[model samples]
Target chain A: MRSHRDFARGFRESLAGGPAPQNATAQDPAEIERRFDVYRNNVAHGLTQALARHFPAIERLLGADCFRGLARAYIAEHPPRTPVLTEWGGAFPAYLADEPSLQSLSYLPDVARIEWARSRAYHAADSEPIAPERLQETATRAGTDLCLDLHPSVQVLQLLTPAGSIWASQQPGGPAPPRAKEWRPETLLIARRGISHVITSVVRSSTGRFVSALRAGDTVARARDRAGADFDLNAALLLLVENALIVGAGIETGDES
Target chain B: MTLPRKAGLGFKPEHFPAITETKPDLGFFEIHAENYMGAGGMPHAMLERLRADYALSVHGVGLSIGGPDPLDRDHLARLKLLCDRYDPESFSEHLAWASHGGVWMHDLLPLPYTAETLSLICDHVDEVQEHLGRRMLLENPATYVLFDDSDIPETEFLTEISQRTGCGLLLDVNNVFVSCVNHRQDPRAYLEAFPLNRVGEIHLAGHEEEELPSGPLLIDSHGREVAEPVWALYAEIVSKTGPLPSLIEWDNDVPDFATLMAEAKRASMILSGDHHALTS
Candidate 1:
């Protein structure tokens, strides 16, 4: 039987797409190389497909061939460690953000990030959606420093460009995305309302204020207040309502305090 | 009771309607456990409808059974839950590979069958069987490369693990052909010494060969029909093990159900008079 140490050693070598057949004759190194390349190709292809599935918008923006080549290179450098394809390529957006070659495509990284968030939201576990009436009840409770629970599948990402618009433009029948002169960081809430992830643009000011307030552990009203002079309660509330993002809130009653 | 000694097909959600309507006399249907991990969806709904008529086996592709890292605890838990849900006629996983290191690779990777590998994999199988409170079938891997560090032959390693862990085998005939041809070993020699009595299931799939300047190397692509030579090996295997529950595995560019069924018919033809000693 092969020892655990040897087993581990062989695994390290085999997994790296290394020279497995040490006994290959000089006359046929090319044959062994070609045979082994098939395995490498399959591994690379599988990871590329996973990335494509995870970042559909990025693939679409780059066109099929270019995207595939980039993905192939990315996979060879960073193969997934886990077997769950859903969890694979979570770092790909950051990778794209750091790639020197992709430096020219400044807007590309943000779009990839948005796409990754959408993929996560699409597959995240289902959570209960707090009913609108729950808010009304919380509103009535005195000294209730209301804090709402975000959905498990919900991700709020702030990006440098209108990635939502860019992602939209690449879809069938959509216009090309407006250039970065339209470049202003936008907040997006990606969440699974019922079955699939739904993405919508959140006003930048409200997003920053909301995140800051949430970090400070303040009430919803206090967070909205942080949105500064231009904070529009009606618009933010309407956006939350439309997206079905408000799960449930707990009032910080004085008695609990 | 042992699974019937007949050929079966891997069940895809797309084939539920036609399979149920036709009620082909397959030995069993195998499904990837991960695909059915959803709480309630079309895959489950269709599987529930189909399981009412066909014997079902759960084949897990994401268990990461032979990884250097400890067996994925949550993955094992989830698989245990699935086993409880399906109460499948049988269950199996691969012996040759680990896909995910921290994550899943979604493909079966090849592992060297060293003593260490034997013990590690045996432990994994033991844990799985303990969690599910039943025996689990472990399948051999087909490989394009042979690790220089491998000290034991594949069959010996598998047999030793089976002996120690009390797990059964899911022998893939095409894998034997592919690996044997790739490594220049006798496919018949591998089969002749195989522990047929402990083999709970069999798998047959198609492979393709790319001719290089040095020689022809077989790739276990499973994208087409099982070749004539592979069928001959299957016949020889069945003649020994009698017959085991067999599946026609086609994961890439899967064709229509009729195509799979037709391929299955060829396997079924070989099982006409055979019977596994253990089950039959």
Candidate 2:
């Protein structure tokens, strides 16, 4: 019997178009090659389909052929580390950022970041959103000690390019994204709308910072101060409440929980 | 709970709304266990709704039950979490391995049928049954290649695993046809040797054929309607097994809910047909 170690190595090598392992069969060499090609094609094709599903905007922007090529390269270098494909593409945005071929499309990586965040938000834990009335009651009671806990699905992306707009444009009903005349930074907030949908919107940089500070365990007063005068704390709070992005409210006794 | 002796379809999220609205008559809905292993959100919500309407079979594709390395404990833990949450009527995994050297290939790769692997697979099955606290049905693989070192016949190998680990079998008729044709063997003969008494569920799916100098090679691509020959094989099995909770698996290029239900309806017809024939 062939040792599993030997079979694993040979099969892995054969998937990359190497010679079929000797122990695989005693059939004609041509039959072996063709049969083994199915396994090779299955791996490449299956993983590529998974990537396309997770990052449809990337596939659309790059076109089908270009996306397949890119996906092949990424699969070759970073095959899924786990069986859960939802967790498999976390490194893809970084992979795109480091790719020399895609350097011309500088915003592609940031757009990919937004796509990944949307996927994450779609699968994030369910939480009951704190209602505006409850939030106000808590604020009145806790006063300056009030702290906010963002929903588990809420994610803020502070991007170097207007990727929030780019990702949104590629969505099913979104407008065609503008062709960039100049590179500018963009901030986006991602959160689940109920359990069945995810919402992505471009937001002011100050609002992004405000959410970030609150996510980092800052009190409502402190996070609002960090957002500077330009940040409308009320508006940000309203957005969070309306989007069901606030999961909890507590009093911070100078100790981060 | 056991899956009803009727027809079911692989649960696709795109059809969630349609399924919920119409509440199609299905025996059970089978979901890939790995798809719901995430922390939460829409997948769970959709599944929760469907679970109320139908029995569920949590089929796992990522357990790597036949891999050379030790079974992934974290993956098992995740499966446990899902099974505990859903308490599915049935749980199943493939006889093939999908991961090696920490890299998951996302496809079920074949393994040599030998004493070495037989023992390895039995141990893994035992561990899974012990961990999940229930018997898991092991589905046979659809392979395009054979191994020179395989001393045990695939049927005997599966039977031995079941005997050793006390696990039931998931007889995928399409797989039997695909492997038998790809290997130039007879599908009926393979089914004859299969342990039908221990089979808890049955699977029927579509396959694509590629011309080869030797003959036509059948690829188990679950992307279309169930083919006639595969349906014939399924009918033969149903005749023998008496309508054991069959499922129509159309994973890729999934048609709309009506098309999927059409496939399941055909299976239901055959199941009822066989029951009538037997009783008469």
Candidate 3:
């Protein structure tokens, strides 16, 4: 008589390609083994489906059979920690980066990263965008000392390859951009503007640096400084305001004496 | 908490536009709770529009209610938030577990029917209902393997849970057929013993048959149209239950909206006692 805990442990082990537990009930031992195999297959297949759903672009890039094989290996290595299937593949991008055999597709991991970011942005918490007047008032009050809070769905990605464009090309109705002759570092900004809408844009490296600094809680002047002399702070600020990406803005008036 | 006694279709994102445009005469639309758990996005927007038109049923697939560990409170809170947002007419989850020790197994796994397992599931159901501030219907699971320590029958197990937790049953006829075929039991007998009076909803889905060396194993794939045998079984159960809210569930290999509507129409005819459709 196995305890429920013991049974669950055994069952999970079997699903992960371990030997079947002796307690599985059936008319015959062979039948039990055969049925357990079906159960294992289902578990594997279901996880594979979940991973495939999250990484559709990766699947398109790698082809179905290749992606499935990679997904199986990935699943075995990093089973989901949460019951939420949508939140299951957070580690896949990093996992792809570590896979030795996939060295040829150097951009695969970054593409996975962008896909994961898109997924997070799509499902991220909803927030009311800061009104333009409020942003302006804060800007006036603190000038260089003003800090801005981006929406919960905002994601800034800096990649060594054009993975963002590659992912966009895979999207429906999106024409594939010609592959760059040389590796060009790309910066991507992703955010959800509407309940079901996600907006992804390729931005200049300066804009990405500025947004990243703001996201790190830097004041407007500090963020602009971090973006360097070439960065267009006003244009970046306009972009953030127009897109409703900034959810909160505040001024730190320290000891007005 | 009641849905119209007509057929409904599982809502899929791919058919969102068509469904919104046509507004098919579905009694209600059911969606997996996990799919809509995201904070905000198109899924919620579309669901908002659909919720305005149709009675919604939140069918949860990842609650892991029968697991060894305590219920995931965060997941529960999220589920509660979604239910509160939608005010769905009904909410349901499967009898099986999909998570153990914080690791989520994507497929619903079976557990032995014992005092410990029964108590565990009853506590989970209680927690879920209390957290959601509503009664939930628990559907029977499709299992390929049985446990040696299971002293109680599946029906009695479910009956005890329902009686103890004061929850309704979600009788998935396809699951009954698939599990019975896999376990070499009679589907009709399972349905006979089922507390159909307590059934709040019925699920009809397609299954795939995998030939094993031992015998034919039925997998509850839900990727195709309802098979004839499952349909007959559903008709038998529905005839007994007198048209419980039934849903056509096509989760994988999902066909176009027209195919789903046609299937829903078929179920609707059966629910309406139109024997002509059954014969056709």
Model 3 Cα lDDT, one tens digit per residue, A53-136: 788999998899999899899888899887778888999999999999999888899899988888898888878888878878
Ranking by DockQ: 2, 3, 1
TM-score of each predicted structure versus truth: 0.79, 0.97, 0.94
| DockQ in order | 0.22, 0.78, 0.68
Q: For residues B208-280, write the lDDT of model 3, one tens digit per residue.
A: 9988776888888899988898889888887777988999999988899999999999999999888766666
User: For model 3, what is the C-alpha lDDT against the true structure?
Assistant: 0.88
Which wins on lDDT, candidate 1 or candidate 2?
A: 2
**Looking at model 1, how many pairs of residues clash?**
22
Q: Second chain TM-score per prediction?
A: 0.94, 0.97, 0.98
Winning candidate number (TM-score) = 2
Q: What tens-digit string does per-residue lDDT give for candidate 2 at A128-222?
A: 88877888888899998999999888889989898877887887898778675844799999889778678888889999999999999898888
Q: Specify the highest-lDDT model's number.
A: 2
Q: Encode model 1's per-residue lDDT on B54-146: one tens digit a residue.
A: 788899888777877777777788788878877888888988555534644456767655667677788888888898888999998888776
Chain A TM-score values, per prediction: 0.83, 0.94, 0.93
The better-scoring model by TM-score among 1 and 2 is: 2
